[model samples]
Target: MNGSYNLSSGTHYGSIGTATCVTGYEIHGTANIMCDNNGYWNGSFPDCIPVDCGSAQTIENGNVSSTGATFGHTATYYCMPGFQLVGPNLLTCNASSEWEPYEPNCQGMYPYAIRK
Candidate 1:
């Protein structure tokens, strides 16, 4: 979250660039800066914090249960009785505030099989 900015040796003025943060962390302020007419860069560096994924969506014929709505958190899927889960049962919130591994679906399972 906290770090220092390094300037390459022999750097000249009027240079513009962007700042970046490590995974699972996000910038909390301006991410771009530029060297002024002077020899110094403008604006202070931003801080990084844990990414936050607001919430999960409700799946068809099933329910979504989550441990937390942030980075590294999990969202679990559940199907009702006689229903079949068509995809993965778990999704994780990533650094981009998104649930990984696409959402799941619930398909009805009949009690008996029929054939011609």
Candidate 2:
């Protein structure tokens, strides 16, 4: 269960003003969740941007997914062996209501980019 969040307005108390914007997933077994400001009452931190998973894609472990500005967000992804993840390894809901930036890369290797 790995996740990342951005601190937004508030004093870490239970209220609309206090919320942490989450930008990652909390995958627990068959359940995949994205944290939002809803955690305030539960004493969970919120993020700057509301975590909204628009679509789902499947990818194996050791893969790379990239996206452009058309995609609302860009993410780095990874998976486990034997099992596969169903969703963009790195994804963002695009302006056209499309999960951009990519279709998902499958393989076991290093994901790096060379500066030209």
Candidate 3:
């Protein structure tokens, strides 16, 4: 388990147990298990999948790109020609399935002037 498990009745026979995922992960499969006469759990463990932050948003006169949006990933922002980035250029995917440091904005530096 990538996280922790809680057992009721102190692992005694006929006790119940549940699996919980830590931050940045979601549980998949059966989350509950029953204790057997051998004082062990009777069900398979669940999979803890990483949280997804979905796709990066696009801004006018700018482009947003990233290799992936899962936890611990980064999104890079680049302004188009004649525009300027108004904030941080990078946003990282956090444990809560959101992008941190906020998304930047693209401002019109010069309508016709080339950006260097």
Candidate 4:
């Protein structure tokens, strides 16, 4: 089966129609779309790709940080104590298809001993 379809940004739609199997060419839209033979969408089905965090921000000054991620994917940051993260440790794609400011994790005070 086929019908008029309108896909908005950051949205993915797929259908097998009335057919027993869905072909790659059956689905159509301005945005990326895919249909499996079983009539199912794949991982992150309609995930928005992420952009790289090329710039670096300074925190407490223990380790350097950079942003790097793709849509439908998450990025995590780790640093030593006393040195915190000034940016988001986790970012998710919003309905607008944009990522929120990186969450910053400020490092806690260092301990006297290496092992607690």
Model 1 CA RMSD to the hidden true structure, in angstroms: 4.4
lDDT of 4 by residue, 1-116 (tens): 32232333323345422212122112222333445556564432232223333333434544433343323344455667565566566664333334555556576665667765
- For every candidate in turn, the CA RMSD to the true structure comes to 4.4, 15.6, 4.2, 12.7
Give the number of colliding residue pairs in candidate 3: 0
Query: In model 1, which residue pairs have backbone atoms overlapping below 3 Å?
Result: none
> Which candidate's TM-score is highest?
3
Span of 10 residues, lowest total lDDT, candidate 4: 16-25
**How good is model 1 by TM-score?**
0.66
What lDDT score goes with residue 79 in model 4?
A: 67
What's the C-alpha lDDT at position 12 in model 4? 32
Q: Of models 1 and 2, which has the larger TM-score?
A: 1
What value does the lDDT take at residue 6 in candidate 4?
37
The RMSD (Cα, Å) of candidate 2 is 15.6
> Tens digits of per-residue lDDT for model 1 on 2-34?
434445433467665566777877888887677
Give each model a TM-score: 0.66, 0.27, 0.83, 0.31
Better of 3 and 4 by TM-score: 3
For candidate 1, the lDDT comes to: 0.81
User: For residues 1-116, what per-residue lDDT tens digits would candidate 2 score against the true structure?
Assistant: 23333334443443333222223322222221233455533433432332344544545455545453322666556666644545466666643545656666545444577989
Please estimate how well model 3 matches the true structure, expressed as its whole-model Cα lDDT: 0.87
lDDT values for all models: 0.81, 0.45, 0.87, 0.42
